[model samples]
Target: MKKQMLLAAMSLAILSAYAGAAPTDKAADVPLKPAAQQTQAAVWASRVLSRYHYKATPLDDAMSEKIFDRYFKSLDAEKLFFVQADLDKYADAKQKLDDAIVGENLQLPFNIYNLYQQRFAERIAYARELLKSKPDFTLDESYQYDREKAEWPKDETEVKDLWRKRVKNDWLRLKLAGKDDKAIRDMLDKRYANYMSRSRKLNNEDVFQIFMNAYAMSIEPHTNYLGPRASEQFDIQMRLSLEGIGAVLQTREDYTVIREVVAGSPAGMSGKIKVGDRIMGVGQGSTGPFTDVLGWRIDDVVALIRGPKDSTVRLQMLPADAGPDGKPVTIALVRKKISMEEQSAKKTIMEVRDGTVKRRVGVISLPTFYMDFEARRKGEKDFKSATRDVARLLAELKKEKVDNVLIDLRNNGGGSLTEAVELTGLFIDRGPVVQQRSAEGKVEVENDTVPGLAWDGPVGVLINRGSASASEIFAAAMQDYGRGIIIGEPSFGKGTVQTLINLDRFGQGDKARLGELKMTIAQFFRINGGTTQLRGVTPDIKLPTIADAENFGESSYDNALPYTVIKPAVYIPAGEVKDIVPLLEKKHQARVAKDKDFQYLVDDINYVKKQRKENMISLNETARRKERDQQEARAKLREARLAAAPSPDDPILVPDPKEGLKQAVSPKPASAKAARQAAAVKGASRTDDGLQGDERSLAAELEAEKAAKNAKDVLLNEAVHILADEVGLLKTDTRLASRVLPYTSDR
Candidate 1:
C-alpha cells in the first residue's frame, strides 16, 4: 500500500500537465460518457478482483450501496455542493452499481458526475459574485469548516446560506492577515475563475478513475485502479529515475496540499516546504512572475513544480502551522533527482548522562528498507542494502566503544521485504523474522539464513505512527524475541501485501490501453502469531505525539483488514529485556515528568486535539484577531521558557561513510535577555528593511533555520536515556546480565 501510494504520488510529481479532451467553454458540454476502452477495462477489473483479491468480497447489493455512497463522498467530501434533491434523483441506482460494473455499464456513474459538475459550476459562480462586495465582518457568527459527517443541504437556499458564511470566513481570514479589501477581492476573483476553467477540463477518464477507485476501496483500502496515464507513471517510478521537486501532493478542496517531502530531494533540502503546506502559486526560473494556482488541478500544479535537472521552480506556500491569518511565503529550489544515498541508513551517537555516569549510545536512523535489486540481480558485490550499510555502521560503532544501539524507524514507510528480514538479522543471531499468509490460508515463514550477531549489545527500537509494513516487521520481531525494548507511539497498521496486475494482458489484442490494478494478495503475521493488520506493534514505553492515531493510521481507513492470530512459530527468545521493562518504564516516567520540553509537547498535543474536536471557527474579525493574538502570545512564552533553561552539553556525532565520525556543531543556548534583544533587533529591522526577491527568500530561509534549531528531538533523547539506564542496570546485576548477551568490544 505504501509503495503504491508513493508511486502514485511521484507519478503526479513527474508527469507534464495533462492535455485531455479539448475543453469546452461551458461545463455542461464537458465529456460525460465512458471511452471505448473503459467498458472492457471495467469488466476485466471486476473479474480479476472477484477471483483473486485477498478479501474475497462479493459484488452484491450490500457492496453496491457502499460503492454508491463512496462515489458521492469522493465527489463532495465536505458536503458543500450537492443537495438532498440531487441525491434523491439517483436513489434507485444505489443498489445497482455492482451489476453495472460487471455488465460494463457506466451510464449511471457518469450521469451523477455530470450533475456534480453542474452544481460545482454554480457554486463557483456564486462565490465570484460574493467576492464583488466586502462581507460584514462584524457579525458575530461562526462557520463550520469541516462538514464531512454533516447531512446534505435540504434545499438550494440552505446551501446558499452555507456558502455565504464560507465566503465571509474566507474574506475575514485574509483581512486578519493584513491584506486590504482590494487585494483580497482581486485574489478571490481569480481563484473562483480558475475553478470554473479547471472544471471544464474534466474528461471521461477522470470520472472513470474516481468511480473505479470508489469500487476498489469498498473492498479494501489497499486495492486501487490506476488509469493508463497513472500506470505509465508508476512504471517510470519503478525504474528508479525521476526528476522533480520531490514532494508528494494531494488535492484538498481547491488547493494542492503537500503531503510528504522526499528526504534529500530539492524540496526537502530547501527546509522551507513541509507537510500540510499549501502551494498557492508557482513560477519558473529565477525571476518569473508567480502564477496563482488556487483552484487548479493538483497534477497541473505538480507539472508547474517539476522541471529538468538544474532548472529552478519557485513556489508561494502557506506554512502548515500558520493558521487562517497567516501570510504566504515564497521559496525557490533547483530541481534534481532524488538521490538513493540520502535515503540510506545513517549513524549518529548521543551521549546520555544518568546522574554522574555518561554513556555513549549509537543511533541508526533507517528512513526506508531499500536495496539495489538490479545491481544485485547482475551479481554486483557492491550493491547497496540497508542490512549491509547497517552492518558497516555497527562495526564502526563497536570501534567507537558505544554501549547501546537504538534503531530509529520513525516515519519509515517500509520497502523491500527481503531487506527487512536481513536487517532484523543484524540484531539477533538468526530467527523467523515474519510470516506471510496467503488468501488460501497457506503460511510461509521468511528467515535470516546467514546470521551471526552484527551488534550484540543492549538494543532499542524507536517507532511512531508513520512506521509501517517492513518497519513494523522488524520492530515486532525485535520485541517478540526479547532482543530490544520497543519505544514511542503505536505504528501505522498496514500488514497486507499488494501485487500489481496488468489489465492489458487480459484485453486479447484490443488496441486501447487497459491500465492496471493494485490488488491485495496476503497478510503478514508476527513470529508470536499476531498479525499487524488493524493493531500495529505497540511500544512497551509509550511517548507523547501530536498525531492522533485514530485519524492517521490504517485503522482510520474504511474496510481495513481485521487483526487476527495464528499458531506461534517455534523460535528462541534472544534476551530478557521483557522482564526489565517495568523498571525501564519507571525510569522513563521519572525523567520526562520534570522535562519542560516534554510538557510543551503534551500541551501542543492537547491544543491540536481540541482544535480537531471543535471544527468550527468564528467568522467575526475581532474574535479571529483575538484568537491569533492568544496563539502568538503562548508561542512567545514557550520560547522564553526554553531560552531560560539550561542546555545539554553533549554534541551529536554523525559518522561520515568515508571519513569516519564528525562532530555536529550544536546551536548555542540563548539567555532570556539575549532572546529579548534579538527580538527587538528583528522588530527594528522590519521597519527599515526593503528586502525583495532573492533577498526576501534568503531571509525566510534563515528564519526557518533558526526555528529548526530550537525544535528539540525530545523522543529520541529520552530513548537514549532509557537505553543508558538499561546498560547501567545490567553492569551492577550479574544475574540479569546472564540472561542477555554480554556487551563485547574489539577496541
Candidate 2:
C-alpha cells in the first residue's frame, strides 16, 4: 500500500536547510557531543519506540518523566533558561530518561544540553546588559509573556528578575513600535547578539534534535526523530518540489515563526506573509542590510530565507494581529519554485442567492491530497492527481449546472493516503473508504474501487483548525457517509498513521548518517468505527473558528492519541446528511444573526479568544499606548464596519466546461477611506524602522489591500449559504430528494 499510503504531509516547509555543513563560528566553540551516529541513533530510537509505537507507549518511569519534561521543554520553551535550581540539577535525571534512551546513554541528554547552553549564555548576557540604560517607561510593570505554564525561577535571584522583565519586554516592544532610544538600543543590541550567536550554534545535530524530539514527543505526538539534517528536510517535503519564500517555519522562542504560507508560494502570493507572522528581518536584494532575525536558527532562519530561484528575499514581518506592540512589516519576496501547480485542486463558482434563486456553489479548493507519485510510478498517462484533479473538477462542476459541492478542507495539511482513498471515491458510489489500525492489531479496509458518482450533488465539507491527516480522512468519510455537511473548525486531530523509518537502512555497515524515524505506525478509523484519534472531525456545521479546541488541534498535543473505537467498515449510507441538519441549523442560525460579515467573524473570534486568555502584557508606556490605541480603535471600527457592509458575493471562476463563460473580475476594493488614507500616508512615513522606501511600498500596497479584504471566505461564505440551503431543501423534498440524490441515470 505504498508503505500504507505515506501521509505525514504536515508541510513544515524549510525545504532545504538542515543536512549538515553549517557549524563554523570557529566550529561553534566545540562542546556538544554524542554524534558518533548519536549513540546508535539513540539505541535505534529506543527500539523503534519499544517496537512500533502506535502508542504502545512504555519507556517506563512514566516515559522518563515525560522525557524529562520534554527535554526541559525542548530546551526552555519560555520557562526561560533553566532555574528551579537548574531543574534541581537534573532532578536525578528524571527517572533516568528511560534508562538513557534504553542504555545508549547520551550523557544525560548531553548534560541537559550543556546546561541549556549555560543558561543560554547567561540570558544573552543579561539581555545585552539590558541594552544599557533606558527602561522606566512610567513603571507599573507586567511582562509574564506566557511562560508556557510558568514556574521555573526559584534561584539566581529569580533568574535575574526573569531577565529583568525580559529586558523590559524587549524595551517595551521597541518602544511601542516606533523605536528611538537609539533605535531601541540598536535593536536590543543586535537582538541580544543574535541570542548569543544562536546559542552558540547548538550542534551535535542540534543536541540530537532536541533529545530525539524529547524522546519522540514523549511517546506519541506523531512520533518523530528526523535529525540527519531533519532527514534531508523530510526528503525535501516528499518531493513536492521547492525553492524558497514559500514559508512554513517554527522555532517560536526567539521568534522565526510564520508557520505555513505556501499555497501559491512566493509566500502565498505575497499577501504580505502571515500565519502568526514574526520573522523579524532577513533582507537580501534591492538593498540588502536588514539581517537581525531576532535569535536566528529555525535552521538559520531557513538558511537566511533560502535563495536563487529568481532571487530577492526581504521579509522583516511581525504582524500576526500585531500585539508585541506591533508594527514591523517590510515584505518583498520574488523567490519561486514551490509548485505542484501550487498545491493543485482548484475550481470556484459560489453564487448562493436563493431569494430569486442564484444557487451555483461548486468550490473545490483541496490544497493537498496530492499524488504525482513519481508520475504514477512512471506509467504517466497524465499523472498529477488529487484524484485526477478532483475527477476533473467533478466533470467541470457537472457541466456548470452546479447546484451544490463545496469541499475546501480549510488549511488541508494532509496528502496521499492513496489520495484520501481516491478522493473518497469521488463522492461515494462504492464502499469502505478508510480504516487502517496497525501497530499489530491489524484492521485495514480502505476501499472505494472507483465506480461512479463523481459529484453526487448537494455536498459541503469545508473544515478548519487546519483540517489534517488526509483532511481527517476526507472529513471523516463525509461525516460517515451521510455524505457531506461537515462545515468548519474541528478536524486536525491527526488520527495516527506516520511511517518514514530509514535510519540509513538500520546502518549495520556503519555508514553513520542514521536519521529518519517519523514512526507512529497507523491508527485512523471512521468507517463509522470512530477514532479520528484525539477527537477531530466534529462538524455537521460548527462554524465560527479562530482555532481553540483547547488551543489548536490534536487537542494541543500533550502527547496526543486517545479517542478510540473500531469495527464498522462494511459501509453503505451515501445519503441523508442527518435529515438536513436541523434544517441546516435553522437556516444557518438565521443567516448568522443577520450577518454583518458573520458579525465581523464573531467579533474576530471573540478577539482571538480574548487574546488567547490574556497572558499579561502592559509594560506601561501609558498602558502600552492605551493598549495600542485600543487595538487601532478596534481596527478602525472593523474597517469601518467592513466599509459599510454589503460586499460578500464575488466568487465565479469555475467555468472550463470547455471554455464557455470566463470573465470573473473582482479585486479592487480596499476602502475604509482607503484604509484611512493608507494610515495617513503611512503616518508621515514612520522611520525608526517602521516604514521605508516608497513608504514601504505604500505599506505593502495597503497591506495587500487589507489582506484581500480580510481574505473573505467567511467560512467559505457560510459554506455557500449552507450549500444553498441544501439546494433549497432538495427542490421541494422528494423524500428528501430520494435519500440525498446522486444517481442521475448517466446524466
Candidate 3:
C-alpha cells in the first residue's frame, strides 16, 4: 500500500469555494490511458513538488477535489460543455486523484480530457450547423458575453440555444463591421473548422500539461508547470532577446493577438502593428503565399513568425477594433535580434521651472532588472547588467547637476534577482534590501555590501500595476527606508520567489526530458517586516488609473499567496516624508484640477470603467449602430475640445543636452508660400521651389519635433512637478534636514 502523508505547509486557508456553474448536456464516454512517459512524468513531478515546493500542499482528498474542479474549469472555463451527468461519471476520480498520483495511475485525468475533447468536437459541429442560417438582426435580445459567472446549459437543447445566440452574435458583429452575407458565412465556417482541427490535434502531453498546471496553480497562482515548449519560450524571454518580430503574442478565443511591441524592435519601429491587433495569416516573405493561422496554437504562430535575423516576415492582421467585415492589412517586417539596448536603462532630464527654481530632475526609466549572466561568467569586462547601466546614468545625471532623481519603473515586469539587490545598493549605502524566507524556515538577507551611496538626493519612484517582482522589491525597499517617494498606482504584488527545476536532471533512460517546474521556493520580505504579496506596495501619492482594479493586480488571482508579516530587519529609516507628502498631494491636486489634460485623463478613465461594468450587449443592430455613433460623436467632440485648448507657451530655449527636452518650436500653420509652392509643383511650374531637398528635410524635422513635443507625457510632467515640490520643501525646512539624512548610519 502507498503511504499517504498530510503535508500542511501554510496554516492559512481560503474559505470560499469555486463559483457555482450549472450543468450542460453530458459528453459521450471516451476512455483514455496515459502514455508511459506521461505516467513517469506525473510520478516524478509529484516527488519534486513534495521535496521542493514552498507550500507542499497535501495530495489528499481536499487537494484532489480542488484539482478536479480546476481541471474541468480549465477545459471549459465559459461553461460551454460537460454537464452534471459527466461530472457524476468522473466523480470517483475527484477524490481518488490523490491515490492515482501515489500509485502512479494517470488514467483518470486523461480520461476526463478525452471526454472534454469529444464534447468540444460536438459543440463545434453544432455551432457550424447553426451558422448555416443567418442570424435575425431585428431581434432585441442581449447575449451575456461573460459566461464565467453563468451556469452551464442544462441539456442539449439549452446548450444549442446558447450556441445559437453565440453564433448569431458572432455573425451580427461581422455584419455590423460591413461584411457581406457570403463573406460572413465563409469566415464563420473557417473559424468553426479551425477550432475543430485544433481540438483534434490535442495529444496526451497537452492533456497532462493542462491537468498538471491546474493542480500546481491551486497551491499558488505563480507556481506553474511549464511543458517543454512553454519552458523553451520562458527561457527565450528570460534571455531579454529573441530573433523575431519583437512583439509578444497570445491567443484570444481563436485569434493570435499582439500583446506588446518591444521598443526598438522592427514591429515597434514600423509603427504599423498595435497592441490588440489579431494576426489572421503569416507569409514567409514578400512573395510567399500567406498561411492562414486561424485556429492555430500560439506556439505554432510564434514558430512561424520567429526566424533568422534580417529575414522578412509578412503578417496579415486585423485591427482589434475592426468589425467582422473589416479587411485585413498586410505588413511586411524585417525580423531582427532583440538586443539589450532595447531593454536597458535609459536616462532623461525634465527641466521644471516652478516660480524660477529651475529644477533639473533626472529621470531614469529602468525597463527590467536584467543581467547577462553568461557574459559575466565568461569574465567580460562590460557584462550588461541593470546596476552598471544605472550607475552610469546616475553619474551622467550628476554631471548635469540634477536637483533630484525620479526612477520610472512603470510596466517593468522584473528579471534577475541579483540585479534588484545590486540596483537597490546604488541608491543607499550598505543596508538590507530584501529578505528571503525559504520553505525549510531559513531566512536569508540580501544586503547592499557597498558602504558609499551612488545617489543621495530627493528621489521619486514612479510605479504602476505592471511593476512586479524585482521592480516591487526595489520600490518597497525605497518606500520602507523613506529613501524615495513612490508615485502612481499600486505595484504588482508578487513577493514569492520561483526556481525553475529541470525535470531532465532527475530522469533516466528514454523518459528523460520531461519539461520543467517553476515552483515557489520562498517568499520575499521588506526591511520593515512587510511583504509585497497580495497587497502590493501602495504608492505614497495615488494617481487615477483607467485600468479596472478588479481585473488586475496580484489580488485578482484566486490562488495568489496571502500577505504576511515577520520581524523587521535591523535598519534605519531614511527620514519622515509622511508629513510632507500631504503638502505635495495638496499641490498635486490643485495643479491637476486646473489642467485640461488631467481632466480629460480622469474622464477617459471613468468612461473605460463604465464600459467595463457593462457585460451584456444588445443584439439589435440598430441599437448597436446608434450606440456606436453616439460614442464616436462624443470622441470627436472631445478631440475638437482638445484641439481648441491652448498649447503650452513657446518651448523653453535653454539647451539641456537631454534628447527628450530639446527646445523645438511647433511649426507655424502651413504657410501660404509653401501651399502656393505645392500647387506650383503640381502644375510643373516650381521645380526649384524652396520647399524641396534640404529645405524639405528641415521641414520634416521640424514637423517631427513638433509632434514629439505635443505628445509629451502628462503624468511624467506631474511627477516632475511633485519632485520639484519635494526639492523645494527640503530646501526650506531646516529642522527637516537632520531627519532626512543623506545615506549614512547616523539617525
lDDT of 2 by residue, 429-500 (tens): 878888888878889888988788677677888876667788788888977888888887776677877766
- Ranking of candidates on lDDT, top first: 1, 3, 2
**Per-model CA lDDT versus the true structure:** 0.75, 0.71, 0.71
Alpha-carbon RMSD to native, per candidate: 8.8, 23.1, 12.4
Q: Tell me each candidate's TM-score.
A: 0.78, 0.34, 0.75
Evaluate model 1: give its lDDT: 0.75
lDDT of 1 by residue, 492-547 (tens): 78887766788998886766688889888888899999988878889989987545
By summed lDDT, the worst window of 10 consecutive residues in model 1 runs over 4-13
- Model 3 segments beyond 4 Å from truth? 1-35, 194-204, 242-340, 377-380, 641-714, 731-747
lDDT of model 1, residue 252: 55
The regions of model 1 sitting more than 4 angstroms off are 1-29, 194-203, 232-240, 243-341, 355-357, 371-384, 510-512, 642-646, 649-710, 742-747
Candidate 2 global TM-score: 0.34
lDDT of each residue in 594-637, candidate 3, tens digit only: 87666766665665555557877788999978866666675665
Which candidate comes out best when scored by TM-score?
Answer: 1
The CA lDDT at 265 in model 2 is 75
lDDT winner among the candidates?
1
Q: What TM-score quantifies how close candidate 1 is to the native fold?
A: 0.78
